[model samples]
Target: MPFRSPYPDVEIPDVTLYDLLFTSLTEEDLERPLTIDGSSGAETSYAELRDQVNAIAGALAARGVGQGDVVALHSPNSPAFVATFHGILRAGGTATTVGAMATGKEIATQLEDSGARLLMTVSPLLDAVREAAALVGLADDKIIVLDGADAFESLTDLIAENRPAPEVSVDPSTDLAVLPYSSGTTGRPKGVMLTHRNLVANVAQAAELLGVRRDDNLLAVLPFYHIYGMTVLLNLAILKRASLVTMPRFDLPEFLRIIQDRRCNFVFIAPPIAVALAKHPLVDEFDLSVVSSVFSGGAPLDGEVGGAVARRLGCSVRQGYGMTEMSPVSQLIPAGRDDIPLASVGVTVPNMECMLQDPATREEIPVPESGVSAPGELCCKGPNVMPGYLNNPEATSLTIDDDGWLHTGDIGTVSAEGVVTLIDRLKELIKYKGYQVAPAELESTLLTHELIADAAVIAGYDTEGEEVPKAFVVLQEGAQLTEQEVMDFVAARVAPYKKVRQVVMIEAIPKSASGKILRKELRGA
Candidate 1:
């Protein structure tokens, strides 16, 4: 289907992502006020945000963070972090997001990889940030310290004293805006480079799909470092002029408190948060009658749990799907289709094209016209896709072809109704006795049992070097399910080879900040 934007062809920003917001923000919008909270709330009208952007841009330029230079932010989801991204863009430099939980060694590697000359980190992390900075041999003048280090004063102070950076004309299509990292089957994180045009398009595309209103109150527990939160909630909030409520960490009781307190209408929740809302007892204590919808992403959401949450909240529980390399959104569940199959990830976003392919040959397969079809790889191409992975030519070449299609390593098919149901991952799918099995299927089925709380599935090899399905189960607090009983439960629902031959009851499974289970860790262990 052709994209139907009321503002279609309204012209994406002619500048960088930060510059876009700086120039397009209006005084009227600012007057309504925007609040970003980390330690506490900082209220700014759009006008103030724009003005500060200009000042920071100037300060950065004065300090030599000019065009093409990469500046890395190692801070959490704070106002400074958001401002720094725009500031770098306005100064004609590219901003890079560093995982806040990254170890000093990992931080050093990314800084070295991106050739980052400047780093912004909160005070408490100064020691780690300094060590990383030293590894790259960054100078004092290049560090824009926020809160943690006493080396540089507050960004507000510097911006207040500096003249606005000289505005330079830039073509959005060519200027790199942000660098976020994504890992492939190799489990190595590569920098995903998104240009100004890419980020702007994703934000607009998100607003189109999600349909934000000025009055919508969004609860943002998702980290800004992750593309999902950065694009869908943080950036889109500004684009749509909606109010955003944020928390640093996911605390179930406190999370419920904020929603009940703010009457938050829109929610950008990850899979883990969805799990809590669906099964955690704290959910019953709070009244979420005001929530309008919740978008779950960053990992596979079990269909059964997601639907139940929607019913409990009396709201639409939708899923928006993407990776860091796609400016974060390629498909979103349409508003009125909340009642569609709970497992489906929704249709391709408007202006985006999707195809299923044979993973080995990369051949496109026809979309299924009826019920569940044979699974294939998901491939996508759109303006919202990232240009390339930063400086990793080999990785970029493999991820995006010369023809411009981005190969998603997921295995799934699009149904006739245009709904997408994930079948398996190309890397995680288990081949057992000449048959294919999806770990997610076994995991999802395991989660549905009243006793099971968390589950991860992997392929176990036998003495003959043959593969069999294995499940690692995490039971809810004060609950336990034995291995044989759990295996029998999954065996009854799935095929013979797909049945769990081994079941291990784990206390907990580690997860990334974005809510993806650390499958690689499980395999290594």
Candidate 2:
């Protein structure tokens, strides 16, 4: 039996995300601050933001950016970045956000895959963005730098053009709004096609589940490029008309200072940040009395860590679970609900159904009677679930079944009250400090080395309790190579987060008859 959401279903507005977010704001509310720059302390009012979004949308239209066109945005969290993202949506175009830290090749791959017609970035990332733009065949004019970089069209120029925003009608349910890449069940990165309705539905669903106070201010330290921040901080904060303090990067001192200065009431974070808040010595130095709750996602939050943070801060500490494909939020701890299980990821949000099924038998698993919960593969069905993956129907079909159920590829258990606790991930991808690192991608890269006969990658924890990708390599007979050499080779090619931190020389890699790596056996070894 599917465990439905305990909360009653909320209404999802049938409109563009921009329309859904702005429709409720009054003229008086426009002058109110919507976002604040954590570094500079600059504020962008709702009215100012809306005007900028309109102007940029007009400029995009003049540049022939029609509906369904993809515009790739590569920048850290900033007020300008926020405007550009919504401007693309305002122009009826899809925004494909790339991580600011991504390498030129990495950005180029996403550019090519998403078929982005334009690239918007900051000057700091210009060198890498330029290389990616060139590799992806994006013309110089099509690449707009946020801060004026010599000769290239700047965001200032676009806003100056001030053409009319294009009027493109869209099917709310089917039209793609944001195309953020996610490594789903299988590890290769693919675009998750989120429709306007999907975003609106999730915002509405979360609004019903979370306790979002109008007076609460949010601390936005998470990267906006990631779905968690994009939805929770950027979109949802705007939906609730909450003031958001944006941080470009996470620094412990700076993070605490902002909380002190801004009196930030709600903090959305990953497990790593939660760990820092729990154990960091500087936490006691700051005045964090105003903070109401700390919410952790992206990775599992240990019960001990959650409890410690709560004890230290004298505030609610909670965890939630979702992937990029689920508009990034399926379950979250309620705003003021202190009674929810410490380690549990909370109940499914409104209008969603979740289930636990035996992986091998494909049978529905019941809640365990032994006090301890029985773990099974977690699956879900909801309006918030993605329509499908972009340009990858095979993966879409595999992930979402004919019955509209999304197989989460995670091992978890649900209580009779609908609370969820994740046990382990069944996917072969490694979670290195909250970033997805595919073992298959690394294995393929390892095979390119002439000295390597075979390779397999698995995740393991270091001394600090952070997940690290550990690679096992079978070298060619008598071929000389050190473990450092293996790690360095992959480090130079891949992103910093995806680099292989540990390597073990192995005689041979165990595999199934069909040539699938037996990762479980290697993990055991």
Task: Compose the digit string of candidate 2's lDDT tens values, residues 293-408.
Answer: 88887766667667878888888887778888899788988876777897788988998888888887988887654454577889998888898888899999999988888998
What candidate 2 gets wrong by more than 4 Å, as runs, is 183-186, 367-373, 428-525
lDDT of each: 0.78, 0.83
lDDT of 1 at 4: 23
**Top lDDT: which candidate number?**
2
Task: State how far residue 260 of model 1 sits from its true place (Å).
Answer: 2.0
For each candidate in turn, the TM-score is: 0.94, 0.82
Per-residue lDDT for 1-525 in model 1, tens only?
221222233345455666455456566777865545623555556666667777888888777778788989887766666666677778888888888888787889899988888887777777787788777787776776666346566676657776687667667897788888774334788988888889888886667668778888888788888888888888888777887777777788878888887668888887878877888887888888999888898988888889888888888888867889899887777677755676888777766777778887766677555765556888888778988887778988898888787888888877766677888678888999889888989988988888887888888877898888888888899986789999999889877778999888788877888888788778765
Weakest ten-residue segment in model 1 by summed lDDT: 1-10
Give the runs in model 1 whose Cα sits over 4 Å from its true position: 1-15, 38-42, 368-373
